[model samples]
Target: MRKIGGLLLCCFLLNGLNGQHQVKTRKELQREVIRCINESAQQYKVMMQRLDAARFPVTWYAKEDKLVTSGSEPWVGGFYPGALLYLFEYTKDSALYKEALQKLNVLAKEQYNKTTHDLGFMMYCSFGNANRLAPKPEYKTILINSARSLASRFNEKVGCIRSWDSDPGRFMVIIDNMMNLELLFEATRMTGDSSFYRIAVAHANTTMRHHFRPDYSSYHLVIYNPANGSVLKKQTVQGAADSSAWARGQAWGLYGYTMAYRETRDPKYLEQARHIARFLLQHLRLPADKIPYWDFDAPGIPDAPRDVSAGAVICSALLELATYTPLKESKGYMKAAEKMLQSLCSPAYRATIGGNGGFLLKHGVGNYPRKADIDVPLIYADYYYTEALQRYRKLGMKR
Candidate 1:
């Protein structure tokens, strides 16, 4: 009877949640953004003491009472410094800047690391913002070299940047590769070298052709024959099945194409981004709060774990997409993003002060299928949540 009663109550609450629509005005969002940023500043100051200069934060494992960390070479290394820079940008706290600079010092050597396709995440997010706020010749040089290292992964025959180095015969590209193109695009802008721009375009074009489904949902991974550039398999490692739409994969596509449109003024990328947004917004199972299940097609409906990281990424993308779209669509996009931010700020998702291992948000699913970092606080989740808050405040509530 107890188990049955619990199940009934859970369903009832979810149904009520689905029926509710919460909205926040620009002023309300501004206040929350300030509060969140200030909280982040305090939390990260504590987090800085938990790790030394050589390692970066990954997530906070509350159950273990541990702060999980990674080296500077992984894909997530930059987000620590990137988050610090974002916090520093808003707070102008010398401690935030000093901590970010320390992480960047440890991370700068990744510019020459040609072994991975994640230098964009590792270098650009850290140094790109650093260069933007405080331009340094060395930063520019590091970014250019990082872009060169990333560009070297592109295959002329495949018309895409190889994402993962596979066994002797296969080339693997994941939809996440789209996020890396911004580095290439920025490199071209910085160097006036059309080669980098051309590579970015080719990679985007090829991914558009192969990575997405008819409905704009993307495959997590597509494997190709290295010699002939022909696709051999389409599958997923993080989703429930080979064909299920992983929540974060969709978020990456939406953000990548929106960014592509911003850089190139290309109508197709805009259309692609809009399509992805619609798919996510209109999906039958998407919760009313806008935080989606780890996989859209996961077997457990209304009970699957929510990926707050995906929500943060999508919220940030939608805020940017709202600007470039038509007024009617833009209004919808902005309102949706506002709702997402509100949900993220609520006590259900946002961590309490001095809690969550010094991270800002909670309930992030890094790789659900792999049973890794499940329902934890992720560094990228906080980074993108901070980014979305910044973007929302900048847009304001003029409409």
Candidate 2:
């Protein structure tokens, strides 16, 4: 009798533990999301008060417990203000809207910058969001000028925009350039000019031809002979190796192609987006939490530092992708994205109030090989995280 009672007690305890693992109800998930967004607003309110007018926050130095600031030229300069606009869209706080406008004034000069391929990230993200929220004649002028600046880098021979000015003989294009195409697409829509759209499609086709491997994983950088559009070399500057998959690069590819499909409704772009999604979702090394390692093939497996920025980008892209795909495909992408959002909102990745130099997400690895912005809270990470939250909320409302 004593032995039987002990066995019954053990069975009951096991069942209780199993019950604890049940999925959260819709109401519970909504409450948690609201809490996360509210906490983010509070933190950013503090950061805006502390930031200087001339400097833009880039990332947080976790070890030193300090905020990293950048000048206007930094590729990531626009994301800070872009994030504020997204937060304001959610919270409707007048102060956030005012702060975002002030930051945009500081970032406005980048509309004429043509030296780098990141003008899309710098101008479009900040000004694009602003234009969407509040349409102003000035914003339209700034964005059109920015699009023209970006268009200046397009090379007819190479069929792609110049990603960097380095090694003038070789035309270097990186996977990240895909994210810039949206600016061109938007410019075409706004200006009734097909030239911008033509340039964007040409670049996407060129990238699709050379940048991807048989397995659908992308190289970080592909060098081409500018004279004949011949491939010079395929390599990676920030990934684990030339052959390895960089987490953030994959995210860019996924998001870029997804946006391309939306703009063009091209079956090839849609197929490419689906392939990239499958590669990321089925990769053997992907973490259980859905936040990927800095590089998928980076050494140390489970011990590698996770890139929350990559995860945020993937989450936002997946949510958008879900809307385009068939129901069968959409289910997988949406489920994976929801899991990623839940992980990102947890305490491990999401910053608590007054923590992480007021950044929303933590553990972003930027340029791991170059030893820059490792294990930091990056502004881009926060930008995409807020975007993902908004996307998720909209998805919920639809359901």
Candidate 3:
């Protein structure tokens, strides 16, 4: 409770400082922050009421039609709780926290919904991260056990987290595994278990070995045999399978490595991040305005589809990279970050058509198999953009 109070207070201090005169003293900033959090709490309360009234459950939706805010059904493992956790972060309301916790409790117990590739976004985003910042026993047990379950899915011979239930008996990895590795890592920390962390590092090392191309751009799918730790195949699970780069896959690589670097301070992870960032920047035809198309070298150029989610995610990665880089590299990455942020904040990419939905960018294509959300707003894009905006405000042109 005290931690939550502190968080809410910090939030107030953060927002309260905004839209006000330049503050010459820390005291003034502190005062403004408290006021802001209080005001924000009220707004969050109203939002919670509206959100709940709509019946939004915190679960991943595999298809567009399943995205209705409320009810009993679940799409995948990550969606619903992830949204609620974000809301709880803003509000610091116990009710929201408990509600989200309750959902996680249920998902943790449900044995059947555990086979997907989204463990990080599903478990970590919903509870693991929260546990790091705020410890709750039920929340902790559920998240750790959930991480263990995901870890169990790892085929020791493959050296990677398995993906795609269709290949049920087989072990394969996807580019998205990078994000979920955090679950394993955090689970290890929470449980004092070496097996979990070891598995995570092995998966990451294996990914580095096979998934990335000579240019540092990555393939979307890699088949590995857990029995002997050999890669059977590496392929693109999305995009034109002829080795075409999926822009979001590239973003995942960038963000994921940067995250790995943050966790281990490994030079290889940092180097990989730089290599991928360079490939993305140099090859991607980012305009003076700066958002990128769905692929860096997407065929058909101007007519190619755009994935604003990539731009938002890459911006977040670049900023984190800048934090540890040398001055020159940091400045360059910072400038790129600003460019991407401007691209999203600009009229061209953002959606004004939504009915009070906070989705910042449209055109995130998940699997063309579900062609429902083409050219429409995505929730994560908005979440990441908001995170970037908050960071930008705090750091003040950090480059």
Candidate 4:
């Protein structure tokens, strides 16, 4: 009762401060975040009952009434376990922790796979959270190995990690590669090895040089000649066109550079992250609800499908970016993030408590150019949504 009264007072004070925009107060947002986390915990528990040791939850097709499953080798394999860990940390549910450990066991071998550039998403999200909550030496070793495997893909000539091996003549690096640097940075921190840090910084610098436009919107892919490290082509594999901005790709760049600044304290990375944030927020196509279209430049504006996954990623990035800016800019970033969170928490984007095959979010567009996983619930959306809530709950009342 005392806590409730205190929060009510805080809410009143916040409303008085931000009366110009009619923003949700921190106290109000905190209550909603707590509700979302509690609801997510219950829904995911139901989801776990339907899964086996060998398969992980990926997405749900509501029209078909089906829950999609994937093996542990897919790029999105770790988000389920990572989300489970996040829930477990907050709720202290033993069932959630057990489910995460089982999934991590299946993911452990991927630390040595060395064929993909997503070990950060695969290993770091799962084992990284586990180590933070439980402090296990095995998790540490696994993460370090995963970082090493990711580092093995770095080409010295290109100054970036190879994202795909589809062609022998081309070294492909996507904007998404920035997210994987977190695992490499963690490995350097763990093993006291400068090589991993160097590789991550080199990749960030190279991506900064070639993957962005003058407006700071990012290209989805940049193909380099492997022999000479010269640019071969810049294209988009998942966007509306070769020159269009894929919404999630832009989100990935924002989150990745913000994370890079967090790990390295480099002002260039911070400035880059801020520019990307401004580009997304100030774009003409950004919806009033704060959720973005699948591709900012995708045809049929005002009617394009919204991507809640991108919104979730962007919200998580903005909350972090807010911490690195001055007081006024930080409040602006936080307001934008709060609006995104409120939009995501609404019925339009959130799944009903028991619907959408137990997934938390709706209307995530995956690989739209290929017509894959469009207008569905995505696992990464849930992971980052939960993560953003956690970050917001921690920082929302600091003012």
Q: Which stretches of candidate 1 lie over 4 Å from their true place?
A: 1-21, 397-399
Each model's lDDT:
0.88, 0.88, 0.64, 0.89
Q: How well does candidate 4 match the true structure in TM-score terms?
A: 0.94
Question: Weakest 10 consecutive residues, lDDT, candidate 1?
Answer: 6-15
TM-score (all chains, Cα) for each model: 0.95, 0.94, 0.76, 0.94
Best by lDDT: 4
| Model 2, span 1-399: residue lDDT tens | 995565356334433433343355656666777778778889998788768987889887866778789888989988988988988888999988898899899999999998989988998889999999999999999999999999999989999999989889999999999999999999998999999999999999999999999999999999989998899999978999999999999999999999999999999999999999999999998876788989999986655678999999999999999999999999999889887888788766888888889888878998899988877888999999988988888778888
Best by TM-score: 1
Q: Which structure is stronger by lDDT: 3 or 4?
A: 4
- Candidate 3 regions off by >4 Å? 1-113, 352-358, 369-372, 397-399
lDDT of predicted model 1: 0.88
- Alpha carbon lDDT at 334, candidate 4: 88
lDDT of 3 by residue, 91-140 (tens): 57787566566566655653234666576766676666456557888777
